[model samples]
Target chain A: MTLLLAVKALTQENRDFLAQYDIDVVTPDTVTDDQLSEVVISYAWDNTIGNKILSLPNTKLKWIQAQSAGVDYLPLPLLAKRGITVTNASGLKALPIAQTVLGYLLYFARGLNVYATRTHWEPFTDQYLISELPVLVFGTGRIGQQIAHHIKAFGGKVYGVNTSGRPVAGFDETFPITDYQAGLAKAQVVVDGLPGTKNTENFFDDHFFAQFNQLFLFINIGRGTTLNQSALLEAIDDSRVKYAALDVTTPEPLPHDHPLFERPQILLTQHTSWGENINAGRVGGLFRLFEKNVPSFMKDQTFIQNVVDLNKGY
Target chain B: MTLLLAVKALTQENRDFLAQYDIDVVTPDTVTDDQLSEVVISYAWDNTIGNKILSLPNTKLKWIQAQSAGVDYLPLPLLAKRGITVTNASGLKALPIAQTVLGYLLYFARGLNVYATRTHWEPFTDQYLISELPVLVFGTGRIGQQIAHHIKAFGGKVYGVNTSGRPVAGFDETFPITDYQAGLAKAQVVVDGLPGTKNTENFFDDHFFAQFNQLFLFINIGRGTTLNQSALLEAIDDSRVKYAALDVTTPEPLPHDHPLFERPQILLTQHTSWGENINAGRVGGLFRLFEKNVPSFMKDQTFIQNVVDLNKGY
Candidate 1:
């Protein structure tokens, strides 16, 4: 069987790992259209070249492993119709993202943001204890659960939102997406960890933000499409939202002269939450997931682990 | 007995609490010079009026309760000569100060500082995992122990510096001030929580900073007199110190155009670490200490609890 590697770059360690398997791993540029059809597996990344390969008529392709957790840009309908198996590197970036969330919470609670922008020596008067604040997380996946775990360690109450309201391990309480109003009302801090999908796009619109009664902090480490940026700005301007820490924003690289950069109440990180010494680990996670599923595929054409639901679009 | 209150302002609750006591409480301005000599106790803040009262010929003043943790600015020699019993509000500001230290650590570990000053969209690559970092705290007092406790909770290794190398509760190891070289050698993050004293002033000088072999973060929530600001700037400029989070700096307001303000590597907080909603609790702690010491003074002229050693100047 042949596996096409669609990632722009792969470390030597990862290349060696692929060499150990009984498959011919080749980059998309090296393989012709006829050879692409013969490929039974692919390690995909979000790029023009990768999408072009996926768009091709590859009848024998059994599975495509995504190097990212969010697969919103992928052709879900086409993949579903062709009966292609899909897996994602979901839990690989959990620790770094969770660390960033905790950083935002502490930043507000300790008044670091106020001090950072201060030109004079006036101390901030409005500061609350982190242990007393309640947090509401908008997803219950690996990333959200890890965030909940860290916040709970600091003695904060955590409420989770998910499709089924299934009890996630670290949350104190779980609420279905349909019944998250109570959680939203009491939350002093709200975290958006939902993936970018048609269902999640503009989920945090003006109406969704209006549910919050008190001044609270809003942090989005999820997809930028999940948030309505205009509504967020209005919330901040009207003092409904006291502060915002956005790791993801629309039109990322944010057009350099964007107005968001001038707002002292907002902290924009340019979608770099999953950073630091995790690049090597990310590739290692993808290879491990691929390796685990390969035995099942060889035996009975069955792929397991991190399989994405086509309709849910996660 | 007359007890002069020298604080700048008193809340209604605090005034009511003092009214409940048998002693006549009077502000510094309200107390006459003749009445001042008759006053046997005082609850003092660090101010010109408070210092003037201390410098006056108050032969009858037996005990003074300092409303702040640091009593370095008081006339220690004069107080000792007069044999006046002095008590400070130590441990009262512990929680807030420790929270600020954790904020600094998380700020650097999660790359919030880099994002705060960025004009472009380049992500920081030098981020570190907080749990893997080693922290060295210079003081075994209430504030230092609390900082150690929070850092340890996050899975970081904590080492303490003290006069006797005595084992502190939350620290994994202890090193005396005389033998802190080994501790400094291995510290990835260093916190100065040492009280301001003649021995400690300018302790973090150029020679002291040169001992560090790797990149490290230096946080000063301790007295500003303990740090040589010029040397700190030099270290940062030379890359010996990767970053600095100074909640306290010499010449308190730090002069608007001080070079430290221009350095992005240093986060100047203008001595506001013990801020937030902890003021009410601070007054309560002082009252509790004063109330406990009063009974002993009334019975046998003995005062205990947070008694400052004049020779030590803390």
Candidate 2:
């Protein structure tokens, strides 16, 4: 029987389907070294188990089904050198992540943050209506498009930024990465959803924030490496940014005394943007994607869904 | 000059427009009793001034342009008996109020409430997406329809309740106020946008909450008189209601020690749903409505826009 390493548990239905393909599933914790060496497919993720498999001298692993959209944490170069195929659960998280971005926006816009801590009833300061606010999202991928779609639902203007100034279906205007400064003048809210990559490193630096013509709410649901924390702090200090909602930080699990936590204007969602219906959204979505890829994998050991380009590291 | 009593300050433009008709605006504080008795029109609201004007024997107050949608505080029956024409800023607040309703929904659904108080990183419990949830809004007028419109934008199902089970433009389903229980089963969030009236008093009491089939979020951007506070507390205690965001509590400025403030599940927004762009929204909208009605009032002492049915007390 072909051994399949599942770092995460599979439903009984999935196990039964894998059995039909003459593949026996084994978990990293319980699987023998002998069984591990013969594993040809890995589902979900576990850093230690993944490194163990990669370090194996005679490993048979041919494909990996990543449980997340961002593959920054994965060893992309090693996977590419070994000529292994990688598939990701990209669009599955778009709904919840996009919903979370709205959550961050509404938190400040509606004064939920202030109301949460207040013991007395006070009239709010000037508040905003999404319909009257213009939002600029820094990536036009599934996640960014979903954010744009939600913003559009509120009748708010949504501007999208991508590698090229190619227009996407939902955005009112599209700007290329190099020309995004032009769209910054009227934006009351800016969101970062760019994936972590060499080109995106520290994309939202001081120079980027300096062009804003008005106070804006900044939200980051993308990789933390794409933002320069010091520059964001400077923007907040200089009053160029009114509030910052960070769901992704440079280090996962930001330390207890981190400076980001000190700012009253900064809200740290702690990288829980993909939290809504996680088990069902991630696992179920991955299983379906894997199910579709199984037939193709069996026929030619390749993918027909969410194939990641190792060079681009999406 | 025709005396016009304005309880609030008007913009220079609004003052200039009113001046075009040879009308001089006077604030409640500055208007003399002689001027008050001769006042033929009033802009905005002040309980003291309204009652004072209403009490004048043989007064010439022909009409009032109210600054808000709800006129419960105004003596409606007295106004009707006195032959005073009333026009309210109803649809003008629908956009901000609707946006606020969405803010309240997203607050609980995306764990903003939890994250707001937390200092450390924690994986969220099962959160929600508006798309997967069903929302029921009572009172399918401009405000309720706006709420439904915003919910529909997120791809969620919105059920609206009105006096009759008549279909409205945006709701997925319409339930008559008398038959709203039929739509209660699937609703994950319930909003009260019903205006303050005799029939609406204590509308969201124990019996109404008892009919809910699932754990739901309750929001009230409507008049606080419509909700029974004790019953809401009970609902929150029993877990039938997960969270409650009250923009309008039973009494404005709920006492610091009010029982409603004791519950962590309840968020008091202090009747600020109409807060977005207030100066412009209320004053500008009222001025425009008053502007459209000015010529009619000058000629026949009647209105052409937002004429309130004093008997209905909206």
Candidate 3:
């Protein structure tokens, strides 16, 4: 089987690991206008050119192995029409996202805000801090599950949101989206780990936010498109949202004069998630595919880790 | 059951909560040298005068409850002589510390420093972010434990240090001070959450830092005395340490021109970890004692959530 692993850079150590197999490692940029028979795609696919790349090899391409946990960007129609099997690296990103979410949460919960607040001469320096606030996580995917586990360790009561009412580990309670209103109703901190899709878009709009019982600590690390920025801004303006941390913003590289940047309550970090250290794993996976002569998910098009449904655009 | 909640401002609602019992609420200023015998004492006692509150009711006090988790300031000899029961609010600060540690970890792991090194812009942004760094957490107390737990949640290998060699929940490995040599040997991120005792002070001196594998993030959410600032400066100068975030500083208000302030590696934020909100929970602990004769940590004495060995000065 001819296996193709696409990534930015592969380390010598990783290259040696893949040398054991018969695989051709290529850069994402290398997969140009011409499509290959079997290609394992990493996260570096440029949105504008990604679909075109997938369409090039219609009959020959067997599968597309994705390196990201989020499947939203995958060229679903091309893969579907060509019958290209797809899989993803969903589990890997969860640990990192969970860590990132906690960073934002703690930054907010710890009152890091006061660090920048003005005080006379100095502030009241105390030894003991307050209790952990209850967290209501709005997603039970890998990211949510991992986040729940960490929150539980902090002695926090975690309520998770999922499509089904099935119980999830690490969460005190898991309710369906039907009960999402109640879950958010009691949440002191609301985390939107929900993958962005047409259905979930504008999920935290004006009406949705109005349902929050108290001033909410809203964090969006999932996808920017899932948010209704205007509504989120309104929540901030209305005082219903105490703090909003957005790791992903629509049309990123938010204008230097963006209104959100000026809002003291909002913390804007670039969409720095997922793009972290891709070369190592992507390269390693490629090496493994080539040497093992493994019928990679890229060739089979049946087994994928993070597959985005084209119809839903997630 | 008279409780004296010592804080700058204690609320009527909290006062009423304690008043349900027979509590006589008093602020630090209201407690004249006389009415000491009739009440129990509690204070936002991390300040310089935390222990002096004990002297007001030097003889009559049953318990010296502290609104702080660390009783480093409690006069050990005095409390010991009077047999004044001292208990603290240890776990309360866990949430914020956990949050702070994770924030720095993200900042450290993701190379947010590169951006921070220059302005918050790019060309620098193209640098890669690595997430798999090992973190060494000193002081396996509640706050430290929480920090370790969250670090692991982010795919970190957590190593810890504490007085006892007991196993902490999230640490992959822990070493008692007797094994300090072994523990410091493997840490990249050294967090100081240790109590500031004579022995603890300057614990992170040259010799201590020389053992680290490579210090990337040096955080002080605990006592500043835990580190020898001079040794730390040298470590930074020689490139042994990368970043230092001091939430608590020695001789705080650190003289604007202190070596640490201007250093690109160190981020100073006064002593503001527990400064999020001075809500009722903080001052209420002391009031709880005064109102109902309940100690902050009586049920779990030996390792009361916030137990401190005053003789050790932390």
* Candidate whose DockQ is highest: 2
TM-score of 3: 0.76
lDDT of 2 by residue, B22-61 (tens): 9998887788888878998888878888788788896898
- Residue B64 lDDT in model 2? 85
Worst 10 residues of 2 chain B by lDDT: B274-283
Which residue pairs clash in candidate 2? B247-B271
Q: Candidate 2: lDDT of B58?
A: 63
Misplaced by over 4 Å in model 2 are: A16-23, A210-214, B15-24, B211-214
Q: Would you estimate the TM-scores of all the predictions?
A: 0.91, 0.94, 0.76
Error of 1 at B188 (Å): 2.2
Global lDDT of each candidate: 0.80, 0.85, 0.63
- Cα RMSDs of all predictions? 2.9, 2.3, 5.7
Candidate 1, A124-170: lDDT as tens digits: 65776677678999999999989988887776799999998999999
Docking class of 3: acceptable
Error of 2 at B225 (Å): 1.2
> Chain B vs. true chain B: TM-score for each candidate?
0.93, 0.96, 0.82
